[model samples]
Target: MRRTSSKYVRHSDEGELLWLRPPTRSGHVFIKVDPTNTSSARMAMGTQQVEVGGRIPVHRHDSQDEILFVYAGQGTVIVGDERAQFKAGTTVFIPQGVWHGVENTSDEPLQVVWVVSPPGLEAMFRDIGTPPGEEAKSLTPEEFAAVAERHGMRVKSH
Candidate 1:
């Protein structure tokens, strides 16, 4: 029998933090609620910090729908064929298989809280990100592509 508790709480600084480097993505991601830490099996939630001028390249999740709420700073967001201004308080819903991306256009860091249904993106994030205080190793573009592919994500080629 699987025994599980439904309650969970975490402080601002209390989460599994990871750092990502340039060319693919540049930011710090704090995974707060994931299958590894919580009892939920349907979704996962986290906060991502994208530095000024940083961008999360266009990509599509084959099986997960994602929701992103901007918590601070400003940027540009591409959803499918549309480009829109993304700022603090802005929210977006991206359906599965739809291509989307974000670029931080402000001088300050762009902080966004993201939730994905059918919890799987976190796995890809874990594979790509370096833990805080660890020797950061950046993945080659080819390597990144391979990992993304394995995670049911297809990134747009430049």
Candidate 2:
């Protein structure tokens, strides 16, 4: 069974009620979509903004698959042992248990819509991420690994 926040209920106007969570990684900000703010279960959605020169560290979800749609800027997506260029309109799929990460290689920020199936990761982000209006902080490798583990994910060695 999954848990949801009672504060939000999905509707076209729900966007006006959703709160923007803090960055989940260094140089990145995430806007989460889940049962907390949307009528979605089984899946979680969100938008992430990766600053210029920033990168999402290589990692893997043990229990959920992920899909990423690049909405702006350019970057490199590394999945397993392969790397591919991504830009606005590009889409990438990462199977569960596969190692993957993203790097913003352009001067502009990389904006992407991210979705994870079997929704639960959003709770992890909300728990581990810095809150809005607070100073952004980077998690130490050990801390990152701990959080990932708690969320059924693993930080990979690259």
* Weakest ten-residue segment in model 2 by summed lDDT: 13-22
**lDDT tens digits, residue span 4-79, model 2:** 3444543322321112322335443354567656666778877677777777878899989999999999989999
RMSD of each: 3.7, 4.9
lDDT of each: 0.88, 0.72
- 144, model 2: CA deviation in Å? 1.1
Candidate 1 RMSD to the correct structure: 3.7
Encode model 1's per-residue lDDT on 1-158: one tens digit a residue. Answer: 11224348767777778898866888889888888888779999989999988988899999999999999999999999999997899999999999999999999999999999998888898999888778886888888888999999999898
Whole-model lDDT for model 2 versus the true structure? 0.72
Worst 10 residues of 1 by lDDT: 1-10
